[model samples]
Target: LADDGSRLWLNYDLIKDAKQRESYAPFTKFIAVASDNQTLKIATEELQTGLLGLLGKKIVTVKTATTSGGIILNVNKNAPSSANISNEGYEIYTEKGNIIISSKSETGVLYGAFELLRAIQTGKSLAKLSITSSPKVKIRMLNHWDNANGTVERGYAGSSMWKWNELPHRVDPRYVLYARANASIGINATSINNVNASSRFLTAEYLEKIKAVADVLRPYGIKVFISVNFRSPRTLGGLKTSDPLDPEVRKWWNDKTKEIHQYIPDFGGYLVKANSEGEPGPQDYGRTHADGANMLAEAMRPFSGIVIWRAFVYNADPNGDRFKEGYAQFKPLDGTFDPKVIVQVKNGPIDFMPREPFHPMFGAFPKTTLGMEFQITQEYLGQSTHLTYLAPMFKECLDTDTYAKGQGSTVAKVIDGSLYNAQYSLMAGVANTGSDVNWCGHPFNQSNWYAFGRLAWDHTLSSEQIASEWIRMTLTQAKPTEQKISDMMLKSHPIYVSYTYPLGTSHMMGESHHYGPEPWLAKSARPDWTSVYYHRADSVGLGFDRTGKLSNALQLYSPEVQQKWGNPEQCPLDYLLWFHHVPWSKKLSTGRSLWDELCERYYDGVVQVGNLQKTWESLKADVDPEIFENVKGRLKIQEKEALWWRDACVLYFGEYSKMPIPKPLTPPQ
Candidate 1:
């Protein structure tokens, strides 16, 4: 039978090995739950279904286990532990011949249930099962850019999963599947609409539609949030002006918030994208970003929600640097925001480039809670055609030392609230999901979504570990086949960076669509939108100079960071072009001229894509035919597009460098 890829990583077919099935048989006799809440009920049902498939035996459900050799779910408010488990943390151990999953809350028990299933699915020995885990960040979520009209922004998959026309009455079973997939991976919150929001969502008619979706997801412990239009007071309500300081505007928002809570009492708070990319904001009325965000925060104060104010704003200054705009706008307003507001900053200073340095705003806001926004949709990284695993990309930013407090102040510590002892912390990924039968478009793209959730729960996991686990459960469990696929997934992102944006170059994608390379593009509606604005290739050099002589953007980092990246010689080769503009003839630390190295990377990337294709072809006998052919077909497209990116960028920059392609690397025809 061919796999349609509908069942994401939760594949639980009967264990082929009789010995392995026997090892899991002892714990499959029954599942006991002490509480009967909705979350616990869902956990019990999930365990039962998973066990029945894995062990081929129906597990009995009971309030309490009267015998040994059964799995038990225990909720103890005062569980003694060393890991300092939070309300949503879980501890699973073997006690008295019974596998015990204990937590302080029902939601924790649900998380533990999934973890226990993961251990069994990954073929771990259960003889001495002892695992204690908790989420590093408090709020881990996915921000969907779906529109009310059933279209999605930057969505490579099919149309929106939500059927807005049939909503509020006939709910799709896919919503439950979506919730289960998210809950299994530790995602607890989601914003279900685009940041470029529609005001109709605030009306009573649409609140009913949102409530229906929320009710289905509530059992899985997933809270629903909305991306709100900043000018709702004027659009939704008949207010004269949408100023933050206006009394009528405040009243309008307060009332609307109250009405939304009535439909879904546990709604997660607003995700606002005001004054960014032509979106309306407080600046239109002569107010600061904090003034806009604080007003919304005040209204949500009566509830347990928060306001996620986006810091993705920038101006179209042909003379000024776009890299410095986001930090300059919100860094000064750090201490001014209300307690319920978290200033959400992207992983990089610029938009979601494949390879970018950590955003300067990460550790700059000491007095305010900062949230990390990562894009998993692959909008800038080949969309659905190429396979790009993003765990390494995420870790690159998370593990970088911000030097906010001292030498060890990594971005992970700042995001987890340990560096600043912050009141709240969150990590959100721009969702890649749609109505595709496979969930994500490419079979491999699902790994990026899975990686985001796993890292969001615990940032310390290595990319290799996540890849191996995903491969074992989602694909073949054969160690040899799994290792081959794992290697491909691990090297995908860097290989993509090599051809697309080698050596810290940024934003050379085609206009608007942002898919293929358009390195020769020189004109756009805004200067920053043009490819030349970022690459800045000229007779002398082939990169933008953000050094003191020009943009002075590197000064935003700490002095410790400045010392490392300030000098062109001392900076890492990966980031050399991002901070400094060197001559084409200049020698790099790699023992090659600057122009030669760039050609080498771009050529090497195309060769690497061919290697990936060969590896996938060798595993055709081990993988599902549907999935194998799907990935194989996409790999062909990847190789074709890799050539496109390599040729365009090399030829475009070669004109400025006035140098022939290196001897070993053939020049594009």
Candidate 2:
């Protein structure tokens, strides 16, 4: 129990320095109080919990300054610097025999508390400390696609954490622990239920349960949101139809929102996945997505809540490419959505594969509020069976330039609202959490959750910075060892993508389970879900023809974007095949034919997986036994999966590419 990952990064291990301990002991001995509230109480409790574990001595709070040497939570005092300090900003320092932690806001005070714990965990001396930090993003949320039955969609980490049957009266200890972990990382809101929602969650009975969960999270400053079934008026409220423009449906939503507020005052509005994946929406009644979204927006406007309408729409047309579905559905209705309704778009058009180009709609919808929805769960990235750190993947999407207005318009700016200067901006991760003893099913997968929160807090923060911090905090801190582990994590995503879904091709995983390759499965009702539709690899060429001459998908982007990606030689190799369908013999920038390049990429992926495995093997003694063994076991699975992907993909593509494996290769198909 002591070595298991139950504590996550909140682990405040003991500091081990004789002289430095003497320097830090004065500050770690006391909790200075200037106010009272559940929030403040929580801050004190966390400080107490973190200190006693780290210093092995209880921290005593004094009404004034008891001893001349006590750590002071001086939040009520004026902050030192107003320049970088927002309300959610804080700084740590020592002066006049009191270690001072001051901030403009209570949340900032809590953050300072967490940092102090982190400093102690990393065995840094508290003397002469001056650290200031504030989140860059306004809203950071976790989207749980968990159902009423306690099952999480795409959740490889067992069932959902929320025990639906035992809520309202019964509180899980893990809920409190979970809230603390999130608050430590500045995750302010949690979209708890599935976006593919059930009307039952909106019912009064469930509201009580949701409220119970909220109470556990309230002290940590985390608000809970529920995803409402769009047709709730017709199904749950006994209305004739759930039309967005209809008076009855509008009134039903307004009253229902009011009822929800009566239970949890800080209930954080709705996350609707409407008219997508066969779910009913305004489109079902010949109304626009904006109409459906705006109805909910208007209903929640009075309560200061916002609606997050999902852009993961799938088309009913059997012939249409699913890759174009979200753009097709939302682009026309861009400016139509109410100001309170923010459109939530996934990072890519298709489901969360190992690799995908940033969604075109991220730049396409300039007039609307766009929120990023990234999947933190390794749903198709070998589930919890593989070790894949996703910070670089996140950075890849965030750093991608959209050129919507011009060249400087990056996806990170668009998501944080700097691009459009919108009042509210959101970044959501489809949570990789569960009831596992260690939270995320695989121990290393916890890095994804940590990275998401860190990035969401500040889009400017480098993934490398977050990885270094997480590795030291979550694991060991020997410089060479930390660097070694960080290198593995930082490169894990590319290695995974190289081995799994390289060249921007996606959704080759098994049809229903999404476990592995099914490149030949082309008969699914939705073409996008089928691998044959995306790759189109055959006798003549490979890759989908997204050009204007083919699917006209290139028309969705601005002229600059079309120019950037339209040409075969100029496009990034990561997405080289996504926009073009090139012949087997076409010479690439790598001086290899398209088939040979495919062979190289697929083989490169497998080799990288082996590289990650080897990197871990070399660091066996530097990391904790439990954590190292945990990742080692998972990386082994990743290697096996990598080989499975390599062999299976090469064998299948050979039937199409018709090229023998390079002369040196053994399996000369």
Candidate 3:
């Protein structure tokens, strides 16, 4: 195997363990599928191909299932006993010496096929296999910040996966493979263009191109979505004013949406990033976010479409706490949005820092359908060089108790529609994929994409379980290798966090690129974009005070959450700096002074990176040489950058805290 990672986790390499292969070979006699739907055809072919590759046995395809040993895939529309399973959910079990996969729809049958293959590839026994699963979130989607000019904003992998010039005439075969990869993980939708959006995509020439991409993905049960420019009525249709209330503007949108449906009938509606980051929206005409979202939702309502309106807006006020901006802007507009509209909120209040408290909007909007937006692309984490598995980061936010309904009201429950009883629910990841040969730049980065899909399907899954499963299916089958890689993945996020922004410190990266450390950055286009605006380091103390005395941002959360994070003495150390400004001499829960604790974390972080390198190096013989070397090289860069961040922050923050670096700490070189 070349190990280029172009195959992603779909690598159906032959099983090397003879005993394990022999045990699974008996069930590889044939594949039985009754339906001739395109999705089912793909599923049937995938199973046949995977079995032949994994077991070295060609399985015959039959029209209907038989009693003998084999795999049976069926769409059971009226299985009253299995009513618990949803339309997109499936049940797989062994019956009469054969494997049976049953679901209510063809898409569910396809998902079960992939699940069956995953179990076999991961060395799970199929002798008495029984499993039933369904997606927790209604819409598991990917938001690609890819643009019409073939550039990806905040993307580290490469240029856009979409080739704008060649589409509609020359479709890339990779598009079909991309659909397969997404379908395998239960991701059902993707917004194909950048949210910053270009009006050119609305032109007739480009809609045809988009239709080409959608055609390839439709068979895999993945619907295509587009990010629409709010000013498209004026920019593309030559309208006078692009106000949501204006009849002309509304008619323009309605006609355009109808035109779009003609080409791509199953088109999933618009993703609008309006009135934020200089993007035009209804706000330019003095209208609210609900006004903007409802307008677009109405346009697509006839076609069963939706509008995913982003809530990532904030004013660049020098005195304002960015943490409070999202909640303040949207809380008052609850229940105003149309039923087809969903408010897309980011995972954290601040831009995707290495660590931050969950956004307060999760449980606040009881009347609005809230969708979670997690950055799968490592924009603030370390881009493409450092390997940081984000499952733990996402899990931390999802599992946090919002205390909205007294207790156990988790952010996961809110976004999955179990908390608010909302009509629609969604979970979206800012895609890390690009034109890179490996899809995501680093091979291990692919794990983050896999983790997002798995967690989206079932939020209850532990980060360790997802890591172990990915390691077994993609990297190695050896138990020791699986354990080692899983351990590395489990620890990678915290290690990166410690060295970069320990104790909830955030927005300390370089201004525009957001690549490396720049704690000394005092000036930028906006005060909120500067490092000083976040840390607020001064002669007497460090950290921004979000308590009632200062910004009063702590009041946004319920009393239960406020009590947990309001007091510096009781707040989790990981979130201390986010809420309080502690003196250099103040002792923390860890028994170390504030200054000493910061130094310890930075030093410990670099040491952990070294250990990760050692661990990966030790697995050279057990893993593919290409992958081992690729990760090894990236770890070296990570170590160097970790030292850079440690040195920069310790020396810079020390100027304000007026404390010496701890005696045992080695100052960054």
lDDT of 2 by residue, 1-669 (tens): 336988888876665545645666766667778678677778888989887776677888876676767767766546555767777778888778787788877777887888887787766767788887877677799999889998998898789999989997789999998998898888989988988899999999999999999989977878898998998998899999999999989999999999999999988889998887788899889999999999999999888789999999886565667778889888889888899989999998777768787888988887899999999998888789877889888888899888888988999989998898888899999999998889898888888999999899887888888888887777876679888888888787787777667776777888988887788888886665677877888899888778876876777777887887888888777787788888888998887887777778778777777777888899987777887788888888888888888889888989987789775432312
Clashing pairs in 1: none
lDDT of 1 by residue, 182-205 (tens): 999899999999999998888888
User: Residue 464 of candidate 3: its Cα lDDT?
Assistant: 91
Clash totals for all candidate models: 0, 2, 0
Question: Which runs in model 3 stand beyond 4 Å of their true positions?
Answer: 81-83, 666-669
Q: Name the better of 1 and 2 by TM-score.
A: 1
Clashing pairs in 3: none
> Which residue pairs clash within candidate 2?
498-605, 499-605
- Candidate 1 deviant stretches above 4 angstroms: 80-83, 666-669
Candidate lDDT values, in order: 0.91, 0.83, 0.92
Q: What TM-score would you give candidate 1 relative to the actual structure?
A: 0.98
State TM-scores per candidate.
Answer: 0.98, 0.95, 0.99
